[model samples]
Target: MPEGWDGTTRDPDEVLYEISMKEDQMLYEEFVQRLEFNKKKVAGEVKCHKYSRRRPDDGWNYMVEKLGAQAKHGVGGGWKFISLPDGSSRPLNDMEKMR
Candidate 1:
């Protein structure tokens, strides 16, 4: 029997199993931290597009439909539909992709 074990019969395999489980938990936690770090780094590198409505009556449904149309046509990169001061819509230049 080891220092913590009782003087009675004790299974060595059970002790080893507990130690392995603890190690596995530690490894999983480290992996999650790394994954979160990587996710934040990638998000910072990526650019998100902004959408603005032409009129006050044009609501969330209209914006969603336009976005769905763009996605259906396989438009990639961060291209945004911006409403100009004169009530005109245009795709904004994606600075990240341009560079």
Candidate 2:
């Protein structure tokens, strides 16, 4: 990271401020969608499973986030399933994969 790396100012503090603002903006947008996605999950229309073929365990993330797969994204949470590289199959809470 560089001082004023945001490419607008020379003040280092300003750079941090700019970053915070940008993150806040994105967070607001995501928060709105969280409500929307949660509704679908509650409606029994989605399931929480790992969706990323590259990163199965998905780390610590909000449930109403890009979900285990396409239509299932942003609506599944709390479920413990890892997306497998096979593209169609997955193992449920396979802790070994977390490695």
Candidate 3:
């Protein structure tokens, strides 16, 4: 139904790249909004902030330090860990194994 998909065949890589770009854009916008919220909280305009990461690699060490302090003061939310099943994960690079 979309005009872009009407009369052309797109390579899979091209479609994946577009999707990744869109995701990144959305995340960046959300990060900016969260930053503003944190600023307000720091200025005593808000009660608290739900601390979350902006990106996947924004210094885990710093995050750990912040969480540690928050927990010590009993002023932060908890964490959740999603576990993967053992022996159920398969290697992605094995093309022959896929068939």
Query: By lDDT, who's the top model here?
Result: 1
lDDT of 2 by residue, 18-50 (tens): 999999999998997788788884456667665
Off by over 4 Å in 2: 1-9, 41-99
Backbone clashes in model 1: 0
Per-residue CA lDDT of candidate 3, range 1-98, in tens?
78667787889999999999999999998998889888874455776467865645422221121344346433444332222243223333355223
Model number with the top TM-score? 3
Candidate 2 clashing pairs, residues 3+ apart or interchain:
51-68, 67-73, 67-74
Cα lDDT for residue 84, candidate 2: 42
Candidate 2's displacement at residue 51, Å, is: 24
Model 3, stretches more than 4 Å misplaced? 1-7, 41-44, 48-99
Clash numbers, per candidate? 0, 3, 0
Worst 10-residue stretch by lDDT in candidate 3? 58-67
Q: Which structure is stronger by TM-score: 2 or 3?
A: 3
The positional error of residue 82 in candidate 3, measured at the CA in angstroms, is: 43
Go through the candidates in order and give each one's C-alpha lDDT: 0.59, 0.57, 0.56
**TM-score for each of the candidates:** 0.35, 0.31, 0.37
